[model samples]
Target: MPRTESPRRGRRPGDSGTREAILDAARARFSTAGFRDATVRAIAGDAGVDPALVMHYFGSKQALFVAAMEFPLDPAEVVPRLVAPGVDGLGERLVRFLLGVIDELGDANPMLALVRSAVGHPEAARMMREFLGEAILDRVASAIDTDRPRLRADLCASQIVGILVARQILELPELAAADRETLIGVYGRTIQGYLTGPLESS
Candidate 1:
């Protein structure tokens, strides 16, 4: 009889299945424990892998969170697009882009997941703050000629986050029922003002 090789007993390292398993485990852990408390060891154990393997694949917990969450948009890519057209109509463009993303992604919006995670978790909130402040708002503020850029960016972020919470998360009847164009028009002016308007009351 021909010698038969023993079949593989478990998932191989660096394999697609292994990666997906890790991601799945990470998602579950993050959902339950939030980013602050979710440990790499725990996630690896959930995936039936070594903690080293998790670090090998994801490099860090933050990277693992990002991978697991599958954020719908990359702010790095979006900031350039928003700033390329000049600051004149940046608010409208931003609102249009944001609404378009929400429309396009619908129930699959990753911002929903992030917001939910950040709501009750301090670490998750910090992650969100850093991501929005540094990646999106800060970059946008830097691209334009303005005073108190950091404050402006933060203000814009507040409005944008509020809109997302009200319309998407809370599902407020008025906001959810409002037309996209109406939202864009109203929010656009507000964001534009934050980006370019005077900081002090005249």
Candidate 2:
């Protein structure tokens, strides 16, 4: 059996011993082997649990990744929330959701970790790109009725990501000091334009 480590970090809302163990294992693997290199079986092995248990608890690799990253949104549920509202003012909803996550999750916010990791670790940056680009943006873009779903998604993704950097990483006083509602409204409109607005040639 592989060595089992105590929960050095992570809180899964209602994390049990086994579940937290799995998360700890996943976090280690992701940090070391990265998102693509890490495998479910390996993570299970590290956790000293059966592969089935990982699936039972987290459902999929992406779900496990999100959880392991300590991100507030549960991949299992966020899509339904984002999908149901359709493309009507999605910018607002998306912005609201991302900001809400940061506000509520606070220091536990994974984006902060992602920024730190991405600075020195190419693997971590790759993982963040794939997770945000594919899991988050691509998934949302696929639902759009526009011609360039990918483009729209990319625009929205960049905007939200920029907000995260400004607010969390740089800690820019203007953005950091801005009222939540006002920031949300301003950013929301830009995000909305990306989702539903017409494109212009530059």
Q: CA shift at 54, candidate 1, in angstroms?
A: 10
lDDT of 1: 0.81
Find the candidate with the highest TM-score and give its number: 2
- In the range 5-108, model 1's lDDT, one tens digit per residue, is 32322456856688888899888887667556779999988887888988998887767877887975556667888889799999999899989998899888
Where does candidate 1 stray beyond 4 Å? 1-14, 17-65
- lDDT (C-alpha, whole model) for all candidates: 0.81, 0.80
Query: What tens digits encode model 2's per-residue C-alpha lDDT throughout 115-184?
Result: 7788678887877776776577778887799789988988887787788788888899999999889988
lDDT of 2: 0.80
Worst 10 residues of 2 by lDDT: 5-14
TM-score of predicted structure 2: 0.80
Model 1: pairs clashing at backbone N, Cα or C within 3 Å = none
